[model samples]
Target: MHAITIPEPGGPEALVWAEVPDPVPGEGEVLVEVAATAVNRADLLQRQGFYDPPPGSSPYPGLECSGRIAALGPGVSGWAVGDEVCALLADGGYAEKVAVPAGQLLPIPEGVDLVAAASLPEVTCTVWSNVFMIAHLRPGETLLVHGGASGIGTMAIQLAKAIGAKVAVTAGSAEKLARCAELGADVLINYREQDFVDEVRKATGGAGADVILDIIGAKYLNQNVKALATSGRLAIIGLQGGVKGELNLNALLRKRAAITATTLRARPAAEKAAIVAAVREHVWPLFEAGRVRPVIDRMLPLSEAAEGHRVLESSGHIGKVLLTR
Candidate 1:
């Protein structure tokens, strides 16, 4: 098997596509012949040696993939050889073949092709878990998604709007915000020039957002608290702006808001399986009905994984950048 391996962490140039031994499925796992994988912010951090794979997981960088089941391991059931599926992985999706725990596998949603399906797992799971399952974003509420043009942000906008919530997004450019608006975001704020706190408050008539899906962590903490509505929920999923920040506890207390920070990659298999199940039950029908779809910016061959990383690092893409096998 050939994969984008990192001999030493540095930049996009550090992703080396080279031959590696193929992985064999373990107990309750299945071997997936990779079709495609998507670039993510976490991949950039992993390439720079900042985020290592969870102990004993694959050393490669991809966190999700679409592929077919080539073989099933001991104790695996219900799925069979030649099953077309996508999976949420702890790592190793960058390779041609990856051993995936059966519990994390999902059938490609109807009407979505194999390669494009690669973009669905991680973003869908993350949005569903945080926005719906954890935050309990209700109908008629407002959801403010930071990094609205990115994969998670794009998915958050669609899902929130599908359930009758007004969506607000902060992107770095007007074009990015325009794309967010096409995806059903009601309030689009260019984070580069606009004060998102004031913009969101104004959009919601001074009530602020009922839920905020933030990727920029500490840099927006105090501001996020100030932007929340009464009894709002703030789900922090990334720390792109640095890890440390001051929180206004008095303001948060006044709003009676709640905060939760999570990463999908570090979760146990059972927990990931639960999220996957919830996505299949709730989100898949949205795709099947043509209400939502994967927003891919472009595709590059798996051997050109470095280029994919460069695209993401540049923040030049409107949505997911895929590396196809």
Candidate 2:
């Protein structure tokens, strides 16, 4: 087996594909022969040594993948060898084979090919968990998503729109904002030139966003609060900007708004299983009905994962960059 390994964390050039020992499935786990994997911001963080894999997880840097089952471990049932599936992983999707907990696996949605399915698990689970499950976004309400051209952002826009919510998004360029509009975003703000808080408020006629799915973290915290409607919910999933910021409890108290911070990669197995189950139940139907689709930017050979990382870090591509076998 071969996997992308970082002997020394540095840049995209640090991801080295090399031969490694095959991974065997543990109890309640299954071995998946990898068909494809997608690059994520977390992968770039891991490649740079800022994020480390959880204890006992694979050292490789991928977070989601689509593949066929090669073997099932003890106590695993309902899923069989040779089943085409996509899985959310703690780590190690950047390999020829990966051992996944049975609970993390999902059947490929009808009408989605295997390679494209590789782009769904992480984004769907992330968006569904934060936007719908935690924030409780409802029909007729406005939801705002930061980094709308991103994998998670794109999914959030489509899912929120599918549920009848008015969706607003922030991207860095006109082209990305146009793509977000195509994906059902009702309001598009180019963050490079405009203020999302002002745009979102104006778009909603000064009512503000009912729910905000934020990725920029501290850098946008103050503005995000200002952009929220009364009794709003803000779900923070990434800290790309920085980690620390002061919170104005007075403002929050006045609006009765709530904020939640979460990272999917660090969650417990049971929690991840629950999220995955929820996604399969509520979100998979959208895919089956053609309401939502995987947004892939490009596909590269598995051996050139370094190049994939470069593309993701450059932020030149919209949606996911996949590494295929």
Candidate 3:
């Protein structure tokens, strides 16, 4: 099998195409022949040597992939060879073959191709787990999503709106804001030109946002709390802006709000399996019904994985950037 490997780990140039041994499936796992993988921020960080694969996990950078089942592991059931599936991978999705736990595999949503479905797992699971499962975003509540035009932001906006929430989003430019609006965002803020806290407060008539899905961690921490409504929940998933920030304990107490943060890659297999099961049962139908779909910006060959990383780093993409087999 051929895979994208990092020779050292620094820049896009670090990614090199090389032949590797075909991975064998383990108990309760399946070997998927990769069709496509998407570039994620964490992949970029990993390429730069800031992160590494978990023990016994793939050393490749992809967190998700869509493909067919080439073989099944011992103890796996309900799926067979040649099944079309998409999987949430901890890593190793950049290769032609990846061994994945059967529980992490999901059927390709109706009306989607295997390659495009690769875009769904990371963003869908991330937003659903954080915004709905962890933060408890409810219908009619006001939700704020940072980086609105990015893959996760686009999915977050659509999902929040589909569930009857008023959505607000912040991006770096007017073009991105407009894209968010087209996805049903009620309020859009250009973070570079406007203060998001004031904009969100005014948009919600001084009530503040009921939930905020934040990517910029420390930089937005104070402002996020300021923008939250009474009893609001703030779920931080990324620290693009930094990792440390001061919190106003007085404000948190006054608003009776709460804060939470998590990373999907670091979770146990059982927890991830739970999220996968819940999504398959609850959210898969939305995709099947054509209500939700992967937002794909561009597609590149798997051999050009470094270029895909470069595109993500440039922030030139509106949605997902895919590397196809």
- TM-score of every candidate relative to the true structure: 0.99, 0.99, 0.99
Candidate 1 lDDT score at position 77:
85
| Candidate 1: tens digits of C-alpha lDDT, residues 174-290 | 899889989999998988899999999999999999999999999999999999999999999999898999888999899999999999999999999999999999999999999
Candidate 2 structure lDDT: 0.94
Taking the tens digit of each residue's C-alpha lDDT, what string does model 3 give over 1-325? 9998887989999998999888999999999999999999999999999999898998888999999999999999999999999999999989999999999999999899989999999888999999999999999999999999999999998888888999999999888888888889899899888999999999989999999999999999999999999999999999999999999999999999999999999899999999998889878888888778788889999999988998999887898999998
**What is the alpha-carbon lDDT for the whole of candidate 1?**
0.95
lDDT tens digits by residue: candidate 2, 120-182: 999999999998889999999999999999999999999998999999999999999999999
Q: In candidate 3, which residue ranges exceed 4 Å CA deviation?
A: none
> How many clashing pairs per prediction, in order?
0, 0, 0
Stretches of candidate 1 exceeding 4 Å from the true structure = none
lDDT of each: 0.95, 0.94, 0.93
Model 3 poorest ten-residue lDDT run: 286-295
Query: What pairs collide in candidate 1?
Result: none
When summed lDDT is taken over every stretch of 10 residues in candidate 2, the lowest stretch is 188-197
